[model samples]
Target chain A: MAIPKDKMLEMLHSLLLSRRFEEALTELCQVEGKIPGMMILCTGQEAVGAGVCAALRPGDVIITNHRSHAHLLAKGADPKVLMAEIYGKRTGCNKGKSGTLHLALPEIGAPCTSTVVGAGPPMAVGRAFAQQYRGEPAVTVCFVGDGATGEGSFHEALNLASLWNLPVIFVCENNCYAGAQRLEEHTRIENIADRAAAYCMPGVVVDGNDAPAIYTTALDARARAAAGQGPTLIECKTYRWRGHGESDPQHYQPKEEIAAWRARCPVARMREAVLALGLISTDDLSAMETKVDALVREAIRFAEESPYPEPREALEDVYA
Target chain B: MPQLTVGQALNQALREEMTRDDTVFIAGEGVGVSIHDNPMLPTAGLLRDFGPRRVRDTPVSEAAIAGLAVGAAEAGLKPVVEIMFNPFFTLASDMIVNHAAKLRYLSGGKSAFPLVVRIKSGAGFSAGCQHSHNLEAWTAHCPGLKVVMPATAADAKGLLKSAIRDPNPVVFFEDMMLYFAPGPVPEDEYLLPIGQADVKRPGRDVTVVTWSRMLGVAFKAAEQLAAEGIDLEIVDLRTLAPLDKETVLASVRKTGRLVVLHEATRTGGFAGEVAAVVMEEAFESLKAPLRRVTGPDIPVPASPPLERFYIPDAEQVITAVKDIM
Candidate 1:
């Protein structure tokens, strides 16, 4: 299922938006202790979020992980509120509760995010089960990292998703590091998707830098899921440019490897793909960046000006 | 206006709730297929009535089912999931505590996880260590979860209904040993408050604070105590997390003594929590140091002799009460 050029370009726009948004958020986080919590920026893996969410319908659901800003933004969450949430402001997405590690906007079918490595898969499987139970032709996407493959929660969810033939897609954003521990340090499998075979599901590996590959793969997974087929594991081989969290030395990742991955940045790669397809020129791309920058600036300003939630609110929202 | 066993009562509550709301569903192992064709199974008649979709029989994937229930609950469904026994609950703790319990709080009130996790607990069946841990303390320890353990069939029926309708995620611990115990249940549909306590037998000498199947031991001990001059007030703490301290406090204040009992190991059992609360809140009212009749701090043995000795019986409760008195 090839995505139309228009849809591909739209995914490009989303990719750019996600990249710029993270860059801006990272910049703000660096501004002399402005943010409350550590930032796990999904910088290099924008295409995985952009292309996958682009293929999804508005009614479909996604459960993201800690480095979830890009995924949530790509899924059409309000950037201003998401930023405010990280800022611990009352106007934030989760009323100043979730912060960065846990951010969810149920209104956009992007519900709660589980920071535990493999937590999102089970929840995604659950929502997919609900969708199937209700007979709603809605696909549920569970976004995890390569580290999650080492976690039992991921395999547990996969087994259930396959056993029940749930309408779910497991997207492993294989950024290769589980907090300074490389993929080799964690598991023996060369591909996280390969583990899907154990669950009796199709596993596919794609270049995380290629927006078209992600978009087309996501569409195929969604179609298969909606058609009553079981889950598919799509491992997007990507890289995180920064430290796992904000500043602890990234001594584990070799500088050469980081530089190599930087050259294949998803946003830049998507831009070149779109350009080669004659969808846009450098001038149009530059203009799009400017617009994205303005939106990010507006979100930052919205976050900065928003009031911190009242201390008493700590007691609220626990029930109901 | 019907005599119902705990299992029958629970089944009726599940049926009534499922019939009342299409959004409510039951999913668990053997929920669809009753074990040994027991018509009185807690989840009996549910599958045939609600079909496979609503009354799902899951594989032994406790974590997946728990996570699935939490996800479905967040996505606008009332899901009641059973983990055949309480020990398996530890496998699903990540979902129950890390996700379901914390989601509404973490989501900043953006979503409601109207999910109930039914864990059958108690140590009488020689089910061994793995199946015997009553981790109500584990659930009650978590801030975001509402943990309820019903001691009677009526309370089981009422509380299960309430847990299903509740807007928060609830871990309902149904006593395994008490499943066949019969009691009077109301014919009309009703829901009990989640965190309320019931004073099953009011007295003025000593307050016996207990919950779940331990209430049976407390009752038996009370019978022996009544034969003497001792008057024992039995306070059944149906809910653990959002504890009804007020009820326990009032009972303790009136009786002027307390004995907290549970089948869970004594180290970190819900018994300690209840005992501590009475000490903190009703310290002046205590005429004797509070006591606890709980399983020793040891893994429940599978052997009949060891398991029998491990569990607190009527004698233990009586002795604990005597010491408190």
Candidate 2:
């Protein structure tokens, strides 16, 4: 399918917004030292989230993993509430109950993002089973890192999805690292998608830095899922530019490998692609960047001003 | 009212609830085929009635079964999934403990996760430690989960009905030994409120606190003690979490002595929690030191004779009560 000029610009906007949001969060964590809890960023993984989420319908549901800010943003979650949540403020999306790792926005089709590796796929199969059982044409998208593929739950989820022929799209963001461990050290296979063939499903691979390519692949997978053609595993080979968390020195990562991935930055690549489209000039792209920068600043300001939850409220929300 | 086995009563509950609500369904390994071989099984004939869409027979994947229920419940469906055995709960603990139990709390109580994980517990049938171990304490320790253990046919039906309708995730424990035991169960639909203990045999000499299959052992001990001019007030705690501390405390206050009995081992057992509650709230009412009659601190033996010895019997319960009295 040919990408439209408007949707292409929208994808670029999402990619830029996600990149800026994480950049600002990194600055707050390292410089100001205000954000609490472990913050896992999708800094170099903008295209995978932006492209895949852009293909989902409004009623479709998504289950994201620990690196979830990009997916939530691409799914149209408000940065203000998301920022407030990471700030542990009362006005945050989960009322400060869930920190960055477990942040979820059900109203925006992303419910129950988990920090447990390889846990999202089984839950995603369940959501898709619900949609299929209820005769709804909607599909569920599950986002997992390549490290998650090693979990037993991931294999169980894939086998069940295939056996039941449920409408779910498994998006594997192969970022070449599971925590500090490099991908080559953990996964022996050349591609994560190859594992899909064991479950009798199509496994497709795409360049993680190419937004349009991912968008096209995800759109095709979603169409197959909604048509009751069962699940499709789409692996987006990408890399994260930052350390696993803010505390890590990341000495395990080779300096040369880091520079190699930085050279293929998804944000810069998407910007060039958008600029190449004659429909938008360099000034238009610059204006979009300025708008996204202002939005990120507003999110930070709202988070800083929001009040912390009362200590007594800690006992609340345990039941019901 | 009609006499029915515990398994029959549970089947009636599943049948009635599925008929009442379209969203309620069962998914588990061999649930449709009834692999346990009990003539009066809860999942018998469910596949024929609800069809495969609702009565899903899954692979031996406990994590997938549990995770599916969590996702389905979040998406506005009430899923009643089976884990076959309680010991296998370890495989599904991630979805059940970390996800289902905490998702509502993680969502800031905005989402209602209505799901039931039906697990068969107790150490009978010589199934050994791997298959028959009771882990109700594991789930009861979690904050968001409601734990239910039915001792009689009536409670088996009523509690299962209530669990299916509950807004939060409930772990419904069924004793494998109690499946064929016949008791009076009401034919009409009824709901037993969770977190309420029932007084099975009321008396004032001493309080015998128990639940699940241990209720039968408590009754036997009461009978033996009653012949000796000693009475035992038996309090069956149907729900472990959201525990009926009021009922327990009330019984203890009236009896002035207490004995906690269960099949699980002594270390970190739920019996310890009961003792703690009495120590915290009704310590002044106790006439003597309370005792706990529980299984030995060892894995359940596979031999029928050793398994029988491993399980705490009426002799042990009676001895515990006598020691406390």
Candidate 3:
């Protein structure tokens, strides 16, 4: 399938916006208690979120793990509300109840995100099952990464989804790291996608930095899912450019390896991909960057201006 | 009124709710097949009636199945998930504690997880250490969750019906020993309101606060205490999370003495929570120090004789009443 010029440019804008948003959050967290809670940054893995979500329809939902800022942005979440939520402000998406770890923006079909590893897969399958029961063509995309793949829930979700042939797409962001331990140290399996094969599902590995490849693969997977062909596990072989959390010392990861992965930056790669296709110009890319930067700045300003929730409000929202 | 066992009452509730709401469904291990042989045998014939879609037979995956229930409920399905053994709740605690319980609050009240987790708990029939445990305190400690433990068959039927219709995550506890215990349950449609306590046997000497399996022990102890002219008021707390302090405090004020009994261990048990509430609210009414009759702070043993010693009995409750007196 040929990529449209406008959609390609839009994907680039969203990727850049998400990256800039997380970058600002990371910098602010370092300013001596400027930010609250631990922020997990998807520094170099923007292409995976942008590309996979690009293929989703407006009615489709995506279940995301702890590292979810990129997924939310790509799925068309309001940056102001999301930022307000990250800031724990009253007008936030969750009304200041949840910080970055648990975010829910149902308007964009990203109803909720979880902090637990391997949390999204089974829920995504269940969502897809509901859609199937209702006879809707809505697709459910589950974003799995790192320690999530090592969890028993991950395997259970995969096996159940395959058995039921639910309309769920499992996108494994194999970022070469899981907490303080490296991926090689955790699992004997060379690839997370290999487990999908055991469940009788199609498993594909793509260069996560390459936006075009991810978009094409995800688009195909989405189509297969809507057609009731069960799930497809697409492992995006990528790298997390930063530590797991904002304050992680990252002494376990070798500096040379980090520098090597950082060299294959997804944003620069996406810009090249668009340029080679003659879809967008250097000036157009620069303008998109300026627009995204301004939008992120506005979000931060909105977050700052929003008020913190009153202490008494904590007693509410538990039952309803 | 039909005299039904606790298990029969629960099964009746499931059938009634599923009939009323097409979206209500059951999913868990052995729900479809072999649940008849299981300890809490309510889901024995559910699969045959509702078929596989409604009564799903999940794999041995507690954590993921609970997650699946959360998603299903969010997507407009009333999912009743049965975690067969309470001891295995440790496997699914992350889902129940983190996702199911917190989804409503985290979603800013936009999403309601109207899911039911039927957890079987207790130590009897030599179920051994792993299969015998009561972790109601864990659920009660969590916000955004309604915890219910029914002691009578009527309450079981009524509360299960309400839990299914509730627009929040409800941890419905089924005491393993109460499955065969029979009580009068009405045939008419009934739904017991959550967060309400019932005074099983009213008296003026002392208040016995208990629920689930311990309710029986408390009743027997009340009978024994009445013979000695120490009339005991038994208050069954049907719901733990929304603790009904009003009913309990009212009873304590009338009696001027309180005794807490439960299958949970003495340390950090729900008895401590109840006792704390009493001390904080009804301290002036107390004629003596609060007494607690609870299981020992040890895992339920495998041997029948050891298990008998581990479970709190009527004698222990009597002893607690005597101590308070």
Collision count for each candidate, in order = 1, 0, 0
DockQ of 2: 0.82
Over the stretch B214-288, how does candidate 3's per-residue lDDT look in tens digits? Answer: 999998888888888989899999999799999999999999999899998889899999999999998999999
- Could you list the iRMS of every candidate? 0.9, 0.8, 1.1
Docking quality class, candidate 1: high
Residue A276 local lDDT, model 1 = 85
Which tens-of-lDDT digit does each residue in A78-149 have in candidate 2? 999999999999989999999788888899999978999999998998899999999998999999999999
State the lDDT of candidate 1 residue by residue for B51-152, as single tens digits.
Answer: 987888887788888998999998889999999888889899899989998988998988888999999888888889898888899899998899999988
List ranges where model 3 is wrong by over 4 Å.
B38-40
lDDT of 2 by residue, B67-185 (tens): 99999999999999998988999999999999998988887777768999999888988888999888888889998999999999999999999999999999999998899899999
Question: What RMSD value applies to candidate 2?
Answer: 0.9
Query: lDDT by residue for model 1 over A175-224, one digit each (tens)?
Result: 98989889998888898888988989999999987878888899999999
Query: Docking quality tier of candidate 3?
Result: medium
Quote the TM-score that chain A achieves in each candidate: 0.97, 0.98, 0.97
Ranking by TM-score: 2, 1, 3
